[model samples]
Target: MDTQHDNALTHALAAIPGPVPPSGVLHVVIPHTSRFTVVGNHLAQHAELSLIAIGIAVYIQSLPTGTEVGIKALTARFPEGEVKIARALRELEAHGYLRRTRVRLTKGRVATRTVFCNQPGAVLRGAVVGAVPVVGPAVRSTTPAPTLVREHIHVPEPEPVAVPTAVPEEPRPVPEPVPVREAAHPPVRLPLRTAPTQPRRPLPHPRALTPELRQAASALLADLRRHAEELVLSEEAVEELVPGVAAWLERDATTDAIRRALTADLPKPLKHPARLLRHRLTALLPPPLPGIHDLAQPRRTPVTPFQTCDGCERAFRSHDPGHCRDCRAQYWEAA
Candidate 1:
């Protein structure tokens, strides 16, 4: 439930010897397999006390070496609360397991850290030979010397002889001589190859439009206006050839962008409004053929006749027969 408590459980379980006692194996295994309750109890009763000592000792041993532990982290590892943890730590310190360095703030809280005070002494006394650096190579311990034993029981006799003196010989000397040679010349190194530069490309010339082509294009556009109510031209199409039209509209070349507007479905009368306007304007303009606008016109006569009578709401071919049959009957009734 608590961080320290949980850490304690974890630490105790971790500390349990890998090779368990035969008697406790089954119990430990059952607890390990079950919901960890048996493990928790074992930790509470046994493993925890030893581990607390270890934690405090380890913390203290680290302190003199300039190591530190936060109060929060310490509490988290201590299964018991700060009181018990502090007590155990103090006990370890008193027992010379540690040498206090200093207290300091960590994460807005205070904590005590220490180092192993007896480490140097242990190293000096050769009890922990490897603990000291200088004596590492020559610290091989002397094995106990074997004892010699003697047994009594022996006897023997001897014979006599004469001795003689004699002569000596000579010594010799040695000599050395040899020289080495080098080749006639040194070797030369080859150079590396570099990539070559490529030639540059030329730009294209602008095209010029012919007068005849321009006129033909204009006429074609006027014809299109006869059928289209809105001119929804593509940007590519305008950029390709409508320079004259755009110039006529006085749109600035850079800023006044002319985008073709689109139209939704229109009623029959409005569908060809642009066409009607184009026809009227075209007729007013001079044609390439002389008097072509006037010559194209057809003659017409004005009419003055009523095809239906307004008063009777009936059909009549002449104005004189204004009253229909239904009106005549109503007139007779009134008389």
Candidate 2:
């Protein structure tokens, strides 16, 4: 959805109270008195920065100082994904408005700290900020500035040269120190990894399963070929997935159910047979059945108490002793 901030034209439109006039924008903005961050036009309107970078800078500035602004954190907050967010962050860093540094902490912990600068102008880049001394730590050696001053002092000059002593530099704004917080993910109620970078190792293979369970699981898999030729699995594939099918058996899911889960609705071409079986085995594996005492009672739908309509004595489900709608309509037509 698009959003716009209100301005003079929007206020003028409201005063004429007819159908709204056509314009390119409709404003719905309320000025932010609280929960707002100050952003300089230099960063916000930067010619070199991307739209993503500009928006991210605004978001980072609005967050509390220690809030996570790392690639992962921003990726979560925005839909632009890791690559774009990382690129935008690089843009911000290159412009001197953002910085990321990896710090090693106690107990083998390493963290990346992110900092945002509001106005990182050319003064910090060694060029003086117009006429004012901007109080930054003098990095004289890096620029040959102090050496040039000394050379100028030694020059044989007839007239006294008054080099302006005012060093127009602000205090070199150090990157803010911040502790990194890891992103939180909930348990089996949710997936441990929301997005896996690498394909997960196929579920605990047949080796850990008992001989009896493995034998049964293998039989079920081998039987799938008889039901559908396309459902064929290699001996190695069967061995690999024996544990997964065994998991279903352990959950008290029947062999027939497992077969149905695997073979039903086979797609056209049915190309990677073993891969299909593996996916079904993992995804459709039933949860363990509860003990008899904990088993859910069969749900019974409530039967509405049948009522006799006053006009027709017809059975209906209302509590009031009133004529049915059809009979009422008939009487109105007669009148």
Separately for all candidates shown, the number of backbone clashes (residues 3 or more apart, or on different chains) is: 5, 10
Q: List CA RMSD, all candidates.
A: 36.3, 25.5
Candidate 2 lDDT, tens digit per residue, 69-153? 6778778888898977887877776766676778899999998766565555532433332223222223333222211111011
TM-score of 2: 0.32
CA displacement after TM-score superposition, residue 209 of candidate 2 (Å):
71
lDDT at 37 for candidate 2?
55
Q: Which runs of model 2 end up more than 4 angstroms from their true locations? A: 1-31, 122-335
| Model number with the top TM-score | 2
Model 1 lDDT tens row, 245-323: 3232222222112112212233455644444333333332222334567778676775556656557678855646567
The local distance difference test score of model 2 is 0.67
CA lDDT, every model vs. true structure: 0.40, 0.67
RMSD of 2: 25.5
